[model samples]
Target chain A: MGDEFCSCDILHENLIEIVKKKMPQEEKLYDLAELFKVFGDTTRVKIISALFEAELCVCDIAVLLGMSQSAISHQLRVLRQARLVKHRKEGKVVFYSLDDEHIKTIFNQGLEHILEPRGFEHAVF
Target chain B: MGDEFCSCDILHENLIEIVKKKMPQEEKLYDLAELFKVFGDTTRVKIISALFEAELCVCDIAVLLGMSQSAISHQLRVLRQARLVKHRKEGKVVFYSLDDEHIKTIFNQGLEHILEPRGFEHAVF
Candidate 1:
């Protein structure tokens, strides 16, 4: 039944089963894709990366990026909808930071790999 | 000179310097975005997620995802160009896996944070 994949040097049955257990259907794939897409934007990534160290209000972010307050606010809205970032209100100012630590770890790990070179062998496909 | 950003409460001067050290110009932000764009695909993400576990040949990966070898190959190509995945040729078979341990660590940390909830607080911004 799944011979085509086997013949083409793709994945085998065991791998299919394993992937299915986690993703179930292709929709889950889309879901995952959308999540990554959020990080694919420069403005968003900048905001996220900045938040990695300290929480900042819109004004601070704007000053940091040399952008306008409106521009920063708009990007913040998109990030909030994606659940990638969250906001807190203090006095008349609002500060934004990562929604979850999952995101922080992901960014940190990626940066770590980019900065460090080791353990990544040119073995396996 | 940077009064606006300070007024908005977004980021501070120090963050701008740090981010600038890595990204330099806005163009670097675009380059980074393009890199993340590869992971923005479900097929690619699944492929990456799978590679995180075991190094599977194309056929094995196809079977695992119940996808066509052609589809898997195409996605693999994208990953390869992005330096996200690398291939190894052994006789008539080729295996593919992540190009860096940084990617693996990123994924692992993301999963860790998603699966476990701790150390993340609703403080600061």
Candidate 2:
């Protein structure tokens, strides 16, 4: 696994170098920017947080969050498009959860940092 | 530490409820959205990566990244404004590094998840 990660670092290094030479054209930067922009919103973050605990239908999420169904639906749509969350339908209700377990690592780790009193004394060397 | 995180979760629950009851006004979401927006860009991601390892000034970064001095400077300014990076002046050059080691925890953790083979096989319990 460490070996594979080493290869991935090499790839990332090559890619970063390529990006530097190209002067960061707006189109690519815009796409990348859009992805990061998704992370910027607190509403979406809250929605993801709620989803982290259980697979919830939009209405349940709305109730749990005290948000309107319409508002929750809109944010969920954005998350869906970004591949951040996926949903399954059962009868009239749709249940939403994280698209992948890997993503939860990001959210959970971020939350840990934000919520911790002292930051990150626990990294594996 | 775990207890504090548990308390943080309670706080998050209360906050989420308040946000939900309010119907998610655009004003609040916008601020949240803007922060997510910043994370969306690839160039910014690259800049963050370069700084992750060591402190480098604009010129060295420009060389290492193959990006223009102006472009790197601009992105650095944005990162600074976001409190993601801090710079120190030494003679004619300014050296920049990750603002707090806490952030590298985020970046390193994210990259590890992204670049690893199966993703997050080693998360601490």
Cα lDDT computed for each candidate against the true fold: 0.70, 0.61
Against the hidden reference, what TM-scores do the models get? Answer: 0.68, 0.59
lDDT of 1 by residue, B1-70 (tens): 4445354333255665664565434665566667677777778888897887777788877777768878
> How do the residues A1-125 of candidate 1 rate in per-residue lDDT, one tens digit apiece?
55563454432555656655764245655665776787778888888877876777788777777788888899898787667778889988898888786786666555544445334452336
- Candidate 1 CAPRI grade: acceptable
Error of 1 at A87 (Å): 1.7
Residue B38 of model 2 has an lDDT of 54
Query: Candidate 2 lDDT, tens digit per residue, A1-125?
Result: 22122232343455446545644344544454555556667778777766766666676666665567778789888877666777888777677888765566555445444444532322225
- Please give the TM-score that candidate 1 achieves against the real structure: 0.68
Error of 2 at B98 (Å): 1.9
* Top candidate, metric lDDT: 1
Q: What share of the true interface contacts does each candidate keep?
A: 0.56, 0.33
- Weakest ten-residue segment in model 2 chain A by summed lDDT: A1-10
Segments of candidate 1 deviating more than 4 angstroms: A1-31, A90-92, A117-125, B1-32, B113-125
